[model samples]
Target: MTRPLLSLTNVTVAAGRAATAKPVLDGVSLSLAPREIVGVVGASGSGKTVLSKAVVNWLEPPLTMRSGEVLFEGRDIYALRGADMRILRQRISYVGANPMGALDPTLPVGAQIVEKMRAVVPGTSRRTAERRIIELLDAVRIPSARNRFHDYPAQFSGGMMQRALIVDALVTNPVLLVADNVTQPLDVTVAAQVIRLMKELTTTFDTAVLFVSSSLPVAREACSRILVMDEGRIVEEQSTDDLVERPVYPYTRELIRQTPKIWGETVSTSRHDDQREVVLSLRDASQSYKVRKKTGFGGVNLVRAVRNVAFDIRRGDSFAIVGESGCGKSTLMRLLCRLELPSSGQILCAGRDIATLKGRSLLEFRGKLQMVLQDPFGSLPPRTAVGKMLEGPLRTHGWRVEARIRERVLKVMGEVGLPTELYEQLPLGLSAGQRQRINVARALVLEPEILIMDETLSALDQAEQFKLLDLFEKLQKEYDLTYIFISHDLAMVRKACNRVAVMYLGEVFELADNERLFFDPGHPYTKALLSAMPTLEPRRYRPEECLLEGEPPSPLDIPAGCSFRSRCPQAVDKCSRLQPSLTVRERQDFAACHLVLPPTASGGIGGVGTTVP
Candidate 1:
């Protein structure tokens, strides 16, 4: 048999300094051949990242590699000298999960990439290095590469920063690439493009990729072989097809079953929609920000973050705003909650114009609408005890009796599945899942009618996400609450939400019930987003054709007509001339696209490149 390009033989990683230290990775063995793609998948604390770090001797202090060898080209990497190891690492690149934190905040994003290339390839001319950097940036689908080359990491979105890190890893043209949950922060469309680029690299440069992610669907779509890790051990290893189709281990089977499929059995929402009371309504709602130019003369530009968008959330509706980053989902959320008054149009909350609400009315509105943010760690007060944090909100909102506040806090904590003992403990002492539950508990303390979950599940692992989803469903039914879930996870959205509004370039491109939206997307952008969603079936997956090309156009200077025309595959002359308005179709669907045929016409549902009129 041909020698494996990289191999880990009986690798064991233990925490702490003593012999009795707990093992995080227990005798985990794996191999990757040249030009091959292998995936390591597990729940959050399953030693997947630990084993990846061990492969390259990147384990930090207190996490020691005990016994076993990591062989690269038949040589033990652990046995190599410091200088030799450094040289070996040049041919083996690693891009970590926290791209923003991974990069130096002091330097420009472009400078960091250039510096890596210079450090790896000695004596390369500055002029040659710069040209190569631009090429790399362009290759990674960063729009207007030269113009944004000097931009800082803070300026880029989470997805943009991830692409920059991927470019940094590939700039050296390494023989082995180690990507650890690199696509976790990205939306499905952008993540698809990045995965497709990785696949192309394996073919173009004959690079072996060791991809580690908690998302099994992403792994199944990208990897040829997969290794399932449980508590400190590799439970099963098999071809991606076998692992997904016929897994021996229960853990592996559970993972396959838990992975959110984009298009599955349609969840019935007819029962929920029967009693329709307009809880929130957006009538020609629009939001615009006056952005000052970074360079040149000081002139203000009206960057329309959200265009003339109109939607309604009926009572107890799980309405979702699905879009990629910078697509105005959050901005619209702000508008809906009265955080930002819409520059144009009316936002009616329970038949009251929220934009005009003030003083006592605004305060009451705030109590009615509560928001749960994405980052559980950052959202919670680290120094504040869970009991104090949860009770303080009720006290501030005029719940005077101390006994009543304590009783309310404890009740909500139990509702969110958090242990009652954790009430007195600081948020820092809690696990990530526990912290998120605390966040949920904090929101529920007010007994809000409308709950806005802004990417709350994006930061969690699959298992943790499932738990939260279950809690969300349970809470929604019990409280008779309406949800406005702002997320990019299509599968999660499909499962949790009854209705979806596909946002793009600050416009509501498509709005439909979950079943029709997923199975038959009318708008091209909606179709692209659905197609980019990673699936367990490898043969059924097609990332290249569906992945959106290049980064979305800047909202600061959005194109006149169809804002999505530049990246859209089905763009025609008419699409460039005029923007399409959302037209209500049969089956209670709405789509803002010139290409989709009318609902009344024959062969209209899947007919692309056809005029509606």
Candidate 2:
């Protein structure tokens, strides 16, 4: 009825040149209205990003529009040229697939945000923009807006930088926001906070969002309408609730059927639950990292990445550390892997003080504890082939025989469900998921007793993610391995971990069984995290169901009582002054909060044991 804010009819995009470039999108069509959010989702390489780019006229040549019509405010933007193209480009805001790479790394967060605002406003003074800059930063829940405004992109954490980028986009005041795979490698709780902020800002400013993700459940929960893509076409279009509950397309059905749920976790027998074969214990271990110079004094600049974090990962048990992004999850994993030495407290591995490792002992420790990083791009050598990548570590550990090394490489590849043909292919040729599998296979080749995965499955689609998680679980049992599963995906945490530890400002807030962590949280931050998990039930969420406001405290200047107190809904004045230690009471669990546990509480989990190395 009302002219659509944007629309695309019969759009088609190609994948490659010599590679047949089969039309990834086929005769797809859709329309959007003012102040509405549309989610685009499908398997990897299904042209979700391509379609979004085409709508904004950002599509490059070769993989041309081919045949299609994209209308912006009743005007075919595809037909616009010169001044018209420039005007349309300015009107549309696009946050790309990689948030980490989107901003100007050389620029300060404040400068980048203001630059966009100035470009459009013309003659708007920097002083006039600076006031709005503080508002924008605070609007996105960034802490220390005035003081940290001068910080460069590298100085901010991954999630903080993402908020900065979103603030940059908002400065343009565009009618439509297209976010492409922006939530990659971050946990669901943090992802929800971003989504909530986007939604609120969209409504306040009368903006529409084209939210693109590989996670169907996230789309289903966050979007009112959804575009289910395949190859390069809109395979199905329906209300988010209707499509998720009653999918008619085979591809959409497969997506729903294959997607791993991230809420209301099921019980699992993971490495952290093993009481009989405990391997590593953290006795009030804490790790603090200094922010890059220029933030302030060294003592003032320190971020307690993991504080008094305690948990036990038994042999063949999986203990998950769950929280939002920038919650110091990676630091905790590094502590277990011995990549980072603790700032205070100690860790005992198999009844020995691992803090004393050096020389050959450190090398031996490294060989004994392997890690899978969140980014395959960062982990893998771009020039190396998959097989050689796997073999290098084996040879470095003194494994002999050239053929045997190759043989061992192939075996691990197959174990991780990689094909033999992929062995000779360079890391450059593989997909994101394949590169991750190689990362996993490389770690597996070491035959380490403890495997620490730092949100490894967060980047992948449900199908790819489940396959790797299942494989890791099986291999843990087969090899008598231990796992420190660090993630904020509550569903995966529940399904993958036997016990759970919650972290904030470099300290373990609460440690318990996975069941209690999800269904019966004790710590206030833990409750907020569990409440923030996106649901696939296709029902409307109450206002209370939305995530907490305010950014996490600067790891540099953590509050005395509770690091999470700034964001905790149940925070009290006492919560502000007295730092809670990891205290065990009754036979329940270890919690860092002042709240007393019920003697006969039935909802949360028990037998959680203690925080270990």
TM-score of each: 0.94, 0.91
Colliding residue pairs in candidate 1: none
After superposing candidate 2 on the true structure, give the runs of residues whose Cα lies further than 4 Å from its correct spot: 15-20, 120-123, 261-266, 270-275, 290-301, 538-546, 585-588, 598-613
Residue 579's lDDT within candidate 1 is 84
Model 1 CA deviation exceeding 4 Å by range = 120-122, 270-275, 537-546, 597-613
C-alpha lDDT of residue 438 in model 1: 88
**lDDT accuracy of residue 289 in candidate 2:** 66
Residue 3 lDDT (model 2): 80
**Per-residue lDDT of candidate 2, residues 302-404 (tens digit):** 6667766666667766878877767777777777777778888889987877989888888887788888988867889888877888988888888899988
TM-score, cand. 1 vs. native: 0.94
Q: Provide the RMSD of all predictions against the true structure, rounded to 1 decimal.
A: 2.7, 3.8
Q: Where does the lowest 10-residue lDDT sum fall in candidate 2?
A: 604-613
